[model samples]
Target: MNRHGQRIGEPASRWRMQIVPIATVMIASALPLMLPLVASSPVLPPLGLLFFLSWQLLRTEMWPVWIGLPLGLWDDLFSGAPIGTAIALWTAASIAIAYLSQRIYWRGFLHDWAIGALLVAAVQALAVFITFPHAPAGHMLGLVLPQIIISVLLMPLFLRLTGKFDNFRLKRR
Candidate 1:
């Protein structure tokens, strides 16, 4: 008890967890830049988007509607995609998730996974559309499909990891 007589090792309240998401999202946005680019298949799971969704779904109260713009701009700078593409998509996804959370009370791993899949697919589709104007539609689909599948399959893992991070953030001495 530093001052308030609270236990030293107790976890923080939900209100204190707000900074975790924004910091985590910012860090995640920069991750792809550190990865070694493969010439054969340029597709990699979108870790930034995955973490953003994970934070939003796991702790809906912490995510503000306007958080997406700066985070998306960060992603656009590093992701090599056109400027404003991620800004629009991330903001839209956040709004959609906010709406869904308001309307639906029941949420499970499967439901979260499905929503993640749809969102990831949408982002990937738009990425292909914006980045590869000259490529054939069939080719774009073939390329993006793998990344989408990988991102979807990894959602649970990302969620678990996000939870762990939250735990770490809230943990006391």
Candidate 2:
């Protein structure tokens, strides 16, 4: 029994695993609000959080869907998008990650980075397709390509920073 005298099956401390996820949602919601003022902010398309959550999805013990709803609601509120649109998209992506999680190991830092990039691209494409199907091809490509590239480049570093926070529980196989 822990100091609380609770059964060992219960987590002795969840604060360790909760901080980053909560902060991620908050930042994801607020970043878009700052985009209009910041000429060259690194956070865009809100895919950095998506990539981060995707990384978590690969863990057997955790599910991305658990985080998706709140993050999506935050995105909807902060972004100009329809109330549930971002939520639906994020929830779907989380489900996809969960399904794929069982099949892939995502073994190395580079691998995680690559997966993050591709997933970010996919999220951008999906969001665009859902929101603005009639938008010009060049416009869509112009926006998505840069965001994807930046997300890919920065993902490793962001992961390293967040990883240092030591939040979230990933079961070891």
Candidate 3:
């Protein structure tokens, strides 16, 4: 034992092991707001959601369901969406994925990507409805459809990045 009562060879804490994953997701969540606002139509993928799901699928045990509350709230604040929207959706998605991952024994990257596509399409479509309730369906779909496509297509990249982040976080100092 050392002066602080911890074992001499033991780490004081393993906080750094968690920093990379959480930071990546948080930064991805805030990406849209970091850009200059010039486009008449939505173009950026829902990177926040994609990255969040990527982490969840990559490591189901890394975070608890409630983790979504704070992360989603952060996304809402930065994405200019109403508060509570992301909180609810992200929390719900977390719970759902936890359940699904537990129930399924046969899993692979393509399976994860398909699940991500379903969630992304649904969530992105819902966001459009919430953001433009008064707009015609065709107009809203036109604006968000491309974004959904991009988000779905980008799922693999985010998933791979999550794996890299996991490896980086676990690397020996």
Candidate 4:
């Protein structure tokens, strides 16, 4: 029994919850890549990053610094982003979130939403800058604005979903 007088399950079941974050984020990262032709648009928000940020903000302890590398590599492979781009960006974002969590003692949905928006916008801008360094400002804005707006708008939904996942992970077997 745990400290609260609850009986824990087998070792495997207890361990299963540990993989939930990485597994879910990795899977979410591939979602944009598998889209059917009809839904293919440059404006589609980066689901993987959205999920990653959501998970990080919701449960900072579950995501350690090192996991970013493999997850970023997975994103790089599937998203067709330049090699090492996601690696650097993902790691940086994770670190930023960790720092933010430490600096801010109290957090709310609005705060998370704002941070998520800024991070999503920054990632999108960096990716575009890296991929199309010479692209016109107007063109870049046109391509990225929709994605940023959508990502920001979806932050609440993602947070809700992550919370549900957390509930599942912590549920007694």
Candidate 5:
């Protein structure tokens, strides 16, 4: 073998691979608070959902179905949402993605983006409803529209971020 050659069969640490993606998404749940300052309105996108979608779409088999339970619990703690909100939503999204992946073998960037956008919008809608249950429908949607738009726009970035993190996680060490 050449000096620069790598052992083809050797793999990176399994523990690292398992932890990196999940840990990153859990951390992403706290991203809004990590911003330099708080905004007056709910402007920050739902980042935890974005990261979860990225990992599921970009590397479909990397996570198990039950993975969402713990991940969502972590998100709920940081998100000021009801304790079970993220848990329910994240688990549902996980199951949905897993189901879709099994039936639809063809997935491209645009396909993933469309899926992410829909999921994000749905999650955002639910969040708004839960937060402002008594508010008018139009007002509830207005509160979350910017957030939904930002999350949709950030889909590509999170997808790229997931790709990079996946590479880092699997890099031979």
Candidate 6:
């Protein structure tokens, strides 16, 4: 590259794309797990991961199908959801994003992320409604709504930074 004096190119293998989001989700999961011990306020919930999935959906260069299975397994183990449930949900969402992506630019990180948050909230509510009928709907609104709002608010900055980092890394390669 001109500034770095390094050869610039696309990632040689698909594995590189897989690594970044997996690592990111794991770190995000850890924050939620640790926040009760570390702070007064609640930690950022999994909306960011959902938004990250949407970002991957919008990206033409990387298809994240392979990453979804392992990440969903990790989420299932970590979040105490039913086995394969998160995987199924995430895969469905990714598929939906991919389909919708064909129609929209998805270039606006904030707008896309806000839409992702809405999807996350709606999907989570539906999941609970069908699978855990005994659970009160009120609980979902009380807990999930605020988290969705927070996630929507936080997504722009994260997407921007990650986009920049990806560009930088691509340039370096």
Top-scoring candidate (lDDT): 5
Model 1 compared with the native: what TM-score? 0.87
**Predicted candidate 4 versus true structure: per-residue lDDT over 1-173, tens digit per residue:** 88865686633346558877777888898887677645334777788888898988898878687667888889889877788778888889889999999999799989988888888889878887777788897788688888889888998899899999878787666
For all predictions, the C-alpha RMSD in Å is 3.0, 5.1, 4.2, 3.3, 1.6, 3.7
Tens-place lDDT per residue, model 5, 15-60, is: 8888899888988999877788767678888788899989988887
TM-score of each: 0.87, 0.72, 0.88, 0.88, 0.93, 0.73
Model 3 agreement with the true structure over 46-152: per-residue lDDT tens digits:
78888899999988898988988999998898887788888888888899899999898799989999999888888888877877789999988988898889889
Residue 99, model 1, lDDT: 90
Model 1 / residue 164 / CA error / Å? 0.7
Candidate 5 global CA lDDT score: 0.86
Question: Which 10-residue window of candidate 3 scores lowest in summed lDDT?
Answer: 4-13
lDDT agreement with native, every candidate:
0.84, 0.62, 0.85, 0.82, 0.86, 0.60
Give, for candidate 4, the lowest lDDT window spanning 10 residues: 7-16
Better of 1 and 6 by TM-score: 1
Pitting candidate 3 against candidate 5, the one with the higher TM-score is 5
* Cα lDDT of model 6 by residue, 12-43, tens digit: 33555455555666666455565545533334
Best prediction by TM-score: 5
Clash pairs detected, candidate 1 = none
Question: Who is ahead in lDDT, 2 or 4?
Answer: 4
TM accuracy, model 6: 0.73
- Runs of candidate 1 with Cα error greater than 4 angstroms are 2-16
